[model samples]
Target: SQKIEQNSEALNIQEGKTATLTCNYTNYSPAYLQWYRQDPGRGPVFLLLIRENEKEKRKERLKVTFDTTLKQSLFHITASQPADSATYLCALFSGGYQKVTFGIGTKLQVIP
Candidate 1:
């Protein structure tokens, strides 16, 4: 069985700093990896996606890296602000009818 894991605890950081989050998986090779941001009582909003062959991807202040060999992905937010605080999730897809696996998510809190 395939499994995805993220930090189970909340991460706290000062405003205007960079925040780095990690995602790890095992037992399967995913063709596409996606990251999302979820706020309390709301569904997740997509942030970024990286293909298995891609080494790194970026959009504005956000960046994502995928390492198929390690079955891991890293999400980064530069110059993060308090508004950036939310639960970040990582989803893995193998490109079939199989269900997408999502990590439990890691909560982030940015202090001013």
Candidate 2:
């Protein structure tokens, strides 16, 4: 079955700590994958992306890694704060980016 999935329902982390989220997909050879952060009432905001040729990508406190063999991607946030709490989604673009699929999204709660 071709499906994308996030780690779990919700992730709870303490302030100043690091939060790691996982995204796994099967039976899809996507050219690249993207991550987005979505707030309660707002649309998802682009976070980061990793190409099939790249092993990892990082921006500020956020890091994303792509593993084509395992068909998995990992998202990390360092120095997490309560203000960073949101639902994170992973999208897969395949067939020349014509087809796209999304995970169920994982909610992150950074407790102060």
Candidate 3:
């Protein structure tokens, strides 16, 4: 059984600081991993994707690192602002027609 775990608690941080979040998994052999952001009452939007062979991936103000050996991923948001407040989700794509599974998400709250 594949399982993904993230912080179920909300992260409260001061604006302009970096926010770090962790994602962990069990029993899954994913071909790729993806990160997504979700605002209130809306579906998640894709952020970054890292293949099994890739060590890291990044976008503006965001960086993600994957450690397949440990079955974990870390997400970082630098200079985070109030506008960056949202729930961050981690998903795994296992390939071969298997449906992807997403973590419950960790809510980030950047205080202004």
Candidate 4:
């Protein structure tokens, strides 16, 4: 079975610094990976997506990297502010049927 894992604890960072979050997977080959941000009591909003064949992707202040060989993905937010603080999730399709699996998500808190 395919499984996704993210940091179980919340991360605290000072405002204006770069914040990095990690996602790891096992037992599956994914065609693409996606990142999302979820606020308390709210649904997740899409942030970025990276294809398996792509080494890196970027959008404005956000960046994502996918390393198929390492079975890991890294998400980064530059010049992070309090508004960037949220629970970040990683998701991907697995198996022949393309079932989607999401990581547990890692919470981030940007302090002023």
List TM-scores for all candidates, in order: 0.95, 0.96, 0.96, 0.95
Can you write out model 3's per-residue Cα lDDT over 34-105, one digit (the tens) per residue?
999999999999999998898988899999999999999999999999999999999999855378899999
Runs with alpha carbons beyond 4 Å of true place in candidate 3:
none
Candidate lDDT values, in order: 0.93, 0.93, 0.94, 0.93
lDDT of each residue in 32-112, candidate 1, tens digit only: 899999999999999999998999999999999999888889999999999999999999998573778899999999999
**Candidate no. 3 TM-score:** 0.96
Clash pairs, model 3 backbone: none
Determine which window of 10 residues in candidate 3 has minimal summed lDDT.
92-101
RMSD of each: 1.2, 0.9, 1.0, 1.3
lDDT of 4 by residue, 1-112 (tens): 7688899799999999999999999997998999999999999999898989999999999999999999999999999999998999999875553677899999999999
As for TM-score, the candidate ahead, 2 or 4, is 2
Tell me model 3's lDDT, rounded to 2 decimals: 0.94
Error of 3 at 84 (Å): 0.4
Instruction: Pull out the clashing pairs in model 2.
Output: none
- 2 or 3, greater by lDDT: 3
Q: lDDT per residue, candidate 2, 1-112, as tens digits?
A: 8999897678999999999999999999999999999998998899998899999999999999999999999999999989999999999999897787889999999999
Model 2, poorest ten-residue lDDT window? 1-10
Q: Which 10 successive residues of model 4 have the least lDDT summed?
A: 92-101
Candidate 1: residue 43 lDDT (0-100) = 99
lDDT of model 4, residue 5:
88
Error of model 1, residue 38, in angstroms: 0.2
